[model samples]
Target: MNTNTGDDKSFLNRLSSIVEANLSDEHFGVTELADKLRMNRSSVHRKLKSITNKSVSEFIREIRLQKAKGLLEEGSDNVSEVAYNVGFGSPSYFSKCFHDYFGYPPGEAKNHTKTESDPIELTEEGKTTKTFKQPSRMILVVIAITVLLGAYLVYQKLSGNPSEKSVIVLPFKNLSSEESTQYFADGITEDILTQLAKISDLQVVSRTSSEQFRETALSSPEIAGKMNVNFILEGSIRRQNDNVRISVQFIDARHDRHLWSENYDRQLADIFAIQSDIAKNVAKQLQTILSPEEIKQIEKLHPKNAEAYDKYLMGQYLCLKRDSISIRKGIEYFNQALEIDSTYTLAYSGLADGYYALSFTGYIDRKIGYARAYEMAEKALDMDSTLAEAYAVLGIVSKFGYWKWEEARKYFEKAIEVDPNCMVAHLYYCSFLDIVGEPDKAFEQVNRAIELEPYYHMTFRMKGIILCDEKRYEESNEALKRSYELNKESYYNYSRIFLNYLALNDEAAALEKLRELFALRPEYLEYKNDITPLYESSGINSVLKMFLDARLELGNEDDHFLIPILATKLGMQNEALTYLEKACAEKTRDIPRMIRKPELEVLYSNPRFVALVDTMNLSPYFQKLSE
Candidate 1:
């Protein structure tokens, strides 16, 4: 016998009211109840607490438990049917809950609801037994069925999730030692990422970031910290011969607890179905709010040509690398895929990515390739503008080609809007904000990108740069170190670490670091500029002249303004005159804005340079630095 305190009774009554109002609709939850009751979210949450003294999740579970118990008692269907009918994504999860809630597995609780919704038709084997006193030929239904069903229905009525935005999909595990099969496992995971990315409400972390943890031994909370997710949808895939076995679990990362987990073993031909099922179940478990458009997008299928689809996935895998060499390889593979199936929108998207990469990597003149890249992206968009990659690359072309800052922002934002989980959009958007001088926003976006892919060196390295710009040099150094430790291959990352050290005025340490950076890239201008501060305070301009010499040899007129400023600061007016003439000849952009530059400190008192500065409309930028 279960007895309730006063608080529990009040909760039961409120739940009963909710059930009466919304017993038919399956989607009702805390958010919905709060809305119907016309109360604030926290207020409704408080009332639910006062009534039942149960957390919303517990109430939901109890409701689900009751439904499962009722169906078993009802005996209208077998165990699988009951599980599905009662909205349990898996019979195994339902049974585990049933066992926990009722002290018996669902199999034992079956056949009890058959005689009536009230009477427990306890089954001896499969059918309900005649009665408590008589062992009839009919099987018996379980007794606890009615109570459980009623409780679950009531729970469903009171709970809701109203926000149709945001999601976090956990990384898929690979259960194979063969590296070849790694691609398939990764393919399945990326496939899920891509599918979920189609949802405008969902955020999907990039597979590069997700895959970094394939070997992580971190706990759920640690993983969540690394991924920066509200919830995690983790799964495992094992491909043996032609069949695949997959198991997925959803965890509330903040709680470090599992919400749901299930395994699926299906034939190769049913792979598409498997992918669809995974996405739907994840959304259901998280109680994700999706618009009708998002729901439809979530259900879209892979290409019909299976072989071509495989090739296209390979192209996607390569293109996702986002480097010069890999982008070309991706282009080759995408072409191979499209040759097999011309209508593959994904392949078109991949090709668009390749051209976009070429433009940015300087493999082609951006001026010439901008329209082509835009055209290719438009084609993919025409076929499917919802593709996150296409949107990201298209956004970049808008930025660099037309200087359409707002339009570029809209596209980048939409790419994230399409999939909040996209690391690319998160990353590039951070840099874009940096360009607009929003260091605070840039700081936030880059940190988010780092959180999404902590183990990925590039993302971490980028976070270090943004952090440095935010004057968080200590934090920036840590990020760069982590990045270097992970990917020991990039010399450029070390150059950055050295720069951060210089910024922090670790001069003794910086001197050695400067040597290291010069060893990595002797041509790096940063090395020459590293010693500028030594003379900047002393008003000596010769301190960093190697940089100016290098710029002069490069024949860039912009160096003219820099040289004259340096010469005047060192009290060398003749040298200043030489460079100022060069600057006036070219009318360099920096020359027009000389007051905005510190390099011109040497020229402040020179009459000729002062007149030149006035002529160049640079007076406004000339205020001397305060001590």
Candidate 2:
């Protein structure tokens, strides 16, 4: 049976051709190739493995590498340009892979030029086979020795840096027949991520950063390159009746090698044990020496009742959706979890998150929502002082709702101390630092948060707002644009961009962004027409007066502090002083942020403003900050 047919060769060649066509698309991997071939993923995998003894992902990477090698030989583009042209997001990763595959760095590509007649053949495992004209045995021996030396050098360089031990836990694919079980899979992934994040030695990417790859076609190596991580953890979970099966693979992304894999078949009640085991296994594999505290954190159990834990997981999942309906449902699920497990600290934190989200969405009264958030957060911390999320919720409520600056700072610092990888805590700390007039420290915290959760839109939005506060208009707009790219529907991001454009005096750009903002938040349209015409006819001053008049027309108590800023912008000194005095007297919620507004800078010289700022008791903190 001469089964190695021409058709087999054609099929393999077709796959190679397709990969070459998309050599620059980092997203073109196994699933995408399967779609292009009009076959199921498993079918494509089986056929490719049968023909070439290589997985589709491996095949694609090889094709890209071959194309990259050719590009480098041409000497037209530099290493970085060639790396990107061949679809490698990271030039360093590309160089590493090239050196490993070709036995030389990309920088020396021109020196090792090969002709069409002397094509290099790659074995099933990506080992380089002999060329058309074989070299001497002595040459082969020398080349083998060189590879061994390279491998050892790489190991030594990587082994010494435990602090560089970083990994991204990709969203586990739900293999269950019921699509509703996807949330359970997501929760398991998040649980492992949280456990890993507690370890001070490892930099675990946030769940949000990995969520985008839930159904992606990108390979582990490609994703790691994009995130600049050394490893990746991916898995699939299947739940059937009272039993569950979880299969996980840990990959050394730099080498595109599977370091370890495990398949667990257990009763549903053992889910927590599975999660804990996985986290412990990952740390052990990375050679990370876990402290006694880190070990305890990893081994901590979820709600003892499986059903209650399930409800809590569902609640956590829904809360991340961040819509009004999802938040309400999440709150209900948290309550259900509490009904079953009265002392579940995670459930309390989830409840706090839902209430805080509802407050932002205006789904509940702000005071009531914040009060509930604070109460639940306190309960969570009462049960588990190590709970970072609870402290983050408390920090946010204390700062924004109660205006307890020192208390908020303490909670935020506590949250980060308990879990250094707590991206939310870092984000809150950045905001707190900015409000306290420590812009440099604020930038540092935001950068740390971005490293932990690069895909999170809020990180960019916060940076944009902070830059706007500092009057770095161009940089502020860039950050806001990045935020907008990540989340097109975010009204707050658009608003910040509008402010940046206005500060830059790019009136046309400002108007365009304002229209987009108005489109997203239609309530602002009520006065859009009233101000647009005035802006062109009577200048920005008239526009400011009209906008302030419209704002004052609302007559809402919350609008009190904003009226002062608007009046100040319009150069109505007495009016601004009057509104500021009233706002200070009322202890308005916006008072903290209002006083920091650049528009209020003109009022800083006014004795009434100085007296009001002094009465707030912030002078000591300001003086301390200056010191």
Candidate 3:
């Protein structure tokens, strides 16, 4: 019994006794234990719920987590041994739960398995300020109840029976006549996902993983079979003017039985309260413990405007495109949201995404846009620092905005610490490391993401880019091809592979690939000139000009100066002077990229080419090499 709430003393005492005696038993669960307790099964469940604020099963999982912690602290038994001893039968399952609970690799938490060195810090500042600022009194109370419950499930997943502790949030439907308002339902679905992410006790699967169920015509048992969740939440959201209606049902997937059902209808202003109610009720139905602070987080309210939020949802839809046009459109709506409400933290996050995406594609003026990205991300953090989306935004800012790799990794790590199943944090951070030439570790993380959300095409593309950069063009091309096959509308599906094939010097293969690529998009430059880095030619200047001239029909023929610059490198002085005159009038994106191209190396000693570079404002490359 909680000392403060002595009213449920007998119940907590009963729960503690049952756990200490039979945790090592493999088949232990509510019915078996309730039978042994000599009370009605429902009565035993009721008493346990009242005292511990968790279900009989969650209480059991908590016991397992506590025991696993003891073993982790002791550093004695191997992970599998500890896992089985606690009741879990599988070693891999235990590691997954460990990651979800503590926000670290099981090996790292074990204190012996060294990953990399500690990441560099963002500042000398202590723990985040937002962790302390927001408080939801009722929500906090619910959090304590749920965390204790979830902690038990984590424990069970580690040591106890896996059958009793897992849960999955289903894709909530819109049940409305309008298909366009589906984003509202999806937003509610995602909000529930995010709220569950805060508990830290349960292994909340990411939205991408769960969204696979959106098209499912399966029953609770069938859905649970695929999701591997013991419990499931299904709901629908309806918005008609200022009135918002949400209907939800919870099921014990093991028996395909309804455990709880409720419908809520409220005004626009009551949306936050509605969210809180849904979370609290779900926690109650699952019979999980929630900590006070966590409850507060779930219940914390920001200003609500249904119309503006709808636009923000649209922004989310577009931002996920990660393309030039979609990114711009996402920002347009995000700004529209902020115009409607000054304190919309999520809108600021969307705006930050637009700026970050712009810089990522190399279309924006990096100096100013990168600065704006950091500023907006900072503002987002200030408004709601606990937001995992905001932290992920900071991760991008640290990378592109600050050019601080270590700092960016720290922010990503921090964001994942707050929400281990954060798909974007995992996906983008892995890409950052891959871009820096750490393909092995990047591959490891991207693989983890695939395991977590195998259905998402972007994850495939992200990892495929790394493979291309590593010169594993076969594997890279294959992965991108797979992603493209899955979603033909995926715009940059072959962007990386296109350059990789060229690098392999397979001209006929490249040309064949280009036909297929052109069939899908009318614009060639979108994928060729922007997304993938295309090299100059075979390691020599004169050869490079000839190479460039040979590929003139491939859309870079207008690059007049490039040919002359290459001619100067090969000692063709007259050719260099002539081409140099033509190049000065050419405007090309490749101009800024030429400094890094290897074929231009021979022209370094040529005075005319040097003068041409100076006139064309190519001093940066010379300066870069010098520095």
Candidate 4:
């Protein structure tokens, strides 16, 4: 009755063959392998565990790591190249895994090639047996001692600087039969994530990254490995009438162990209390000490009206969809929430976000959209001064709408100070830094934001835009490609890609991207295909005249600074200076950015341009170039 003999051997043979065939595909994990084997995931898992004494994920990882080690020993490629070749999405993650598994980093693997051995090969009996070259007794003793010392040092280092506490709250499942309640479960998951992020003592993965695993077949360890998180929280929500039920479990993802589990059945009004309780319990279980202010922040509740809160959550759920139609619908839901509770600060903040989205996406008149955003943001802050989102909204409005640089900077700084994990604040501040002639500082802030929300399309798009401005075309295209992969329908990502191609002087690629941009939003067809044709046909002077004519006809106030850049690109030094003076008089936020723009180099030699730079107090930022 030993089932591990015949078919088991065949299964192991097939699995080994598949793994070897796809050894370089980093994404060839348990799910893909299961699909390839034509077996259900659970069945594949059980069979693999029984045969290999390891979970499916662990088996696949070991295969990849072993392949990577072999590649390194061969010395054909550098460590990073080997990492990517072995299907690792990130080289650093690959290096860490390699070091943990092989007792040495890949960088040092080449130097110690004499000690390396071939990886274990699978036999027909479905068992692993290593073959090693025989060595002298003294050599064996020396190797054993070296291994013991390395293990001791690793233990000491791990104990001293314990890894930072991190968690990913997976999207809560809707256990209710009614699919309409899915939004409620999603909102609850996001609220819990937001509460944890406010602690400043934990690295909470952003909703975008966690949402990717909503329907994934990957095991807990696999998800945790990909996200680089130690803990995972998953839950389900069941709602019946006025009573709601939530069951949550906190898991130590690294060890695949459940650390805590709780269930709550409460009236709808007590949902806020339930959320707060869950967050506090998680923090306590993780042994994270929260400051008094952090505790108070977490304990703070929104409006008392359950209906209003539900409406607000619905609004937030729609807002996160990030489309023009969804944004408008979100606005309606926010307004509904406000109608139910006129004094709801979060509702006001949501409304402000909706308006800001409208303005930023060009779905509405910028002036009207931004003015409403400003008003709503002010109201939110007046009601709750500690609201980080409200401050972020105000900062964005000030930066893009009013061009109030100092005020925008202050608001952005205050938002981060209030909530250190606020990704929006970090993103806006990064863009602000870029516009203010501090590309190095801007790069740092964008990277921090990316660390917080790695899968967020807008964050990557902004990174691409910033890199494009810095004239790092190759890096900019890589980021933009990632952003496009996250959400291919986004015109924002496509536009940046277009700009990057243009900067790199790849006219065909730029045109292709421009067409994609136009395809996504046909309203831009005229601007992309028709009005801007003069620049390609004649020169910047012809394009400048056409721009002037269009401005006179359209009367758009934004992007006025582009006129000077066009003039400068045409080699019209006086015209560029004149346009720059006009832009300065208008308090254009883009003025500072011109310092690094190659198009504006002609104007830089002018004393007026230098004076304008000095007047903006941008000399200090430029001075950093030398330092």
Candidate 5:
């Protein structure tokens, strides 16, 4: 009995050491702990249960909760930061677990003393031998049962039938001695992600989220737990003059075991073929059968000249920065790529994206910028009709440039059909639905985009907008606040906050947000000054009138569509009808989007407004709300 007590204490001490070493790993559960201890999973479960009278999962959770409690008491970080540091992806989940374990929430831990005793005890009475007689015979029986069960499970897993597979391709490490080759490594990682995204049978985490783990010290299982994926693909790239070397490994994140690994040494021109082979091997390992169409898409090589491809990759990297200077530089690099190889379809697509971004951000003349975007997007489609990004660009042009609502919808839908994982397509379609008076659909699509790219601020902003349209003011504010937290300098997000506060009838909050917006972009000072006095003196209607008058004086065709909504808000029915008729004649895209505006509620009952809606073919989307 004394020997058994010593063995139990030794086992628990070893287990405690392992758990403490990986306290920050969220996925250090049964399988990972088993792998670390060099024991079968069932054995780990049985041993942990015998020692602590708790399941393996419960043991892991208790360790995490205890660590989090200590951190909270230290007061080094807030609840959210402490939660993530202790390997909880969500602070809310951590709070629930902490409360369940300690009978108090984590927020109270900092103010409270540590009085709760440890659950595990090393007393002689706690030994397993005390609870069961004939310990040796029982151990042999349990081992025999565990062996049979383990063999059966291993046989089933090895028979090639596995559960749903999802993977994250971590940012590839740049093994090259030159720091300048980092872009090359990033480009390769993004290319591999894009190739895998084309497979509808596979779930590939976006580069935005995976890139966060580039320098992370967390183990593969920990990362997989945070990303909620089954497999992890990580590699290193080394480029020298004209030769490139890549080393890649695939790991089953659940088991914390490597499934496959390879090394490739090839010329720079064979990079596309290398990416294709790696993707195919990963798919095979995951037991995903690729269709012929998906195979073609994965193998498609655009730029024949390696230098032009390099330039295009640089251009794409710059364009993703989404700043005016970076956009101009991206355009220059894309033009250089086109000059090197005129038939480069991706270069044209990049050019279109750059110009469209410039136009959307109001940094350039919309008419000229969107016209150039339309031309380049059409050229890209002419070169390769199957390109999902080209289709998305065409959809943007149709919606913002030509105001062809039906055409825009078709193009957006076609982009999704071509590539279901296209983030741009999903976001654009969400915007389209918002404009067409389908707030519910817009909310659904935006949520989908958020799931695919959880760290992206733009999707959160769009979600806020959809919620605002639905009049869910509190939720809208929450989403917008999240967006603001992600990007504090975003003028667009600030403006949305201002509008949301105004709609919620919080004038002081609205004015505060307005000041923040003006502080960020002083170019809007004129409009801000003009609207503030009218709002303070005569309320929102007078402010609407002032905005309508200013827009009329601006003499921009795109500014005219908003006049009808403002006029209707001020009870000027005749003026509203005239402006609405003019907007219909001009085929303004905002007219369709204004269908769900609360200010336009009065116009919905007017005969001339009904006529204008019919003329614009917007009757199908006209809201039929009950009073």
Candidate 6:
């Protein structure tokens, strides 16, 4: 019989309902469940813990396991099929968890009988909460010993022995009196992550993914479960003038065991040493043997001067803001860092990144931005031949700036070879694959980027864009919605969502998203008067025509490639081909990306379009990569 109060029972029922609803979605976790419950994650976690004494993940997994058990008993599916049906991504993992939870393996569940208590608990006390009513003393003793031993073995299996080394380093707390020191703390965390990521055997979650927990109330174990990692690294930083204090702790989040921790109090100049020590210690604790190259990469320090490094960190912090002004300001800081030490490879790379951002976002002239970016990247590479970022920047220049498609591929591959965990390389390569008409390879590359930084908004945005290009409108919108939820202020997500709506012929939804996007980006608001009435009268094509007009009126030489895309959507085949010919003749930066859109699929058999694509020499490389 159930022992819970009415409120507790109802709450548990509602929680179960939510979990069961999303049982097949492996990405559905504590946060998504909390959102469905219309409560903060902390509130849901605390209330559920008080009732069940199990973490949210344990609760969700229990529901999945219960459904899997029922399915198995019904003899409806094989173990692998049932595992996927019940939200487990790996059949072996499901079997292990099933055995741990139910005391019998999934295979034996077909003939096994359940004798546990009504109020199921995940803890050891759950094993004996309710026993046989009138068992003999000798039998009771034997059962008790067996249960204790079984519990011990399960505990040892789950907590004592570890698996493949994977970890998420949460954002470090900034304890400095000055709030501005937060950037320094973040830079420290990022550098440590970089060092750890250099080790091929260690899987380190990127800073963008781990940064989501900066103000979270969840426990380390909960975070670990959400990130699908077994360990967590957390720290606090306090900086004052020339002195800094950093306290770092490494934990086996699964067992809640503190594997190692240390406090470092040193001058600002010793930060490099501190970062290296932390990475080395983490690797040591994990019993990972670092290759010589990984050791060298971790130990390499830059700008020897503390002040120069400080400016570089500031540049990185600002550039992450991703706005035109902040990016330009970041460039200034990078330049300042280089003035202090002209040989600082990272500062040059930072400059290249800033210019790349400016060019990519159309904040600067394409030629000027790419030229400066290329120069800075080359300089950085000359100083540090092993710099993965330099190679990635060169790849960007080769692809979008020069249209040297094969050269771009080599650069991106080399970047990944230099640093297997280079998210930039993976991301840019994803776009390259898509441009070459290899959507499957593009999907794989983008998914790899998502794995490295699951919480990043851009990765999902890219996925949405790819899906939309494939005419998978509903799936595209789902990915775009996730991207929007991650960063509501990002107009890019709004734009992509509306584009998907347009593709789906949902003009009303498209208009709504357009309005939201224009609200975020007021510059686009100037065209509202010209568009809204036409949109109501003639629908999405009219809106696209007005946007095309606006783009033409802007007289931006770099954006001429957009003319063909809009023209193609309106079924103006001759106009699209003519403008595309001009765009190709003028060597527009975006022409390659625009030509591959599904809207232009009508031109696949057109002689002019075929000739244009042939001139670009894309098909051979597409076949090469697809092979």
Enumerate residue pairs that collide in model 6. Answer: none
Please provide, for model 4 over 526-598, each residue's C-alpha lDDT reduced to its tens digit, 9 standing for 90 to 100. Answer: 3445434665788445644543433322223343444565456556678778767765665544455545565
**lDDT (0 to 1) per candidate:** 0.57, 0.70, 0.60, 0.68, 0.68, 0.72
On residues 306-399, what C-alpha lDDT tens digit does candidate 5 reach at each position?
Answer: 6777777777876876665456556766777788889998899998898888766555656667778878888998988888888998898787
TM-scores for all predictions: 0.51, 0.64, 0.55, 0.59, 0.59, 0.64
As for candidate 4, its clashing pairs are: 26-87
lDDT of 3 by residue, 449-550 (tens): 776777788888777766765658788888888777766656456534545566677755654565465444422222333222232333323334433433
Model 5 TM-score, all chains together: 0.59
Q: What is the lDDT of residue 502 in candidate 5?
A: 69
- Assess the local accuracy of residue 107 in candidate 6 as a C-alpha lDDT between 0 and 100: 82
Model 2: residues with Cα > 4 Å off, grouped in runs:
1-160, 267-289, 360-362, 518-535, 542-567, 571-591, 605-627
Summarize candidate 2's per-residue lDDT along 1-627 as a digit string, tens digits.
457789998898888888888888865666567888999867887787777666565677778888888888888999999999987777876886676566456887886655422323323332223322211110001111112222222343355587557788888898987666766777778777776666666667788888888888997779988988888878887767767677777778878988766566776555555545544444443333446675567546445666777777777776777655445656667777788889877898998888776654445666677788898899999988988989999998887777788999999999999877788999989988888888998999999998777898889988986887788989988988998888775656765566567668797787777667644432344446555787779987786676565445333342344477667767788998887777666555546666776657777767887787677656665555446
What total of clashing residue pairs does each candidate reach? 33, 0, 26, 1, 0, 0
Clashes of 3: 26
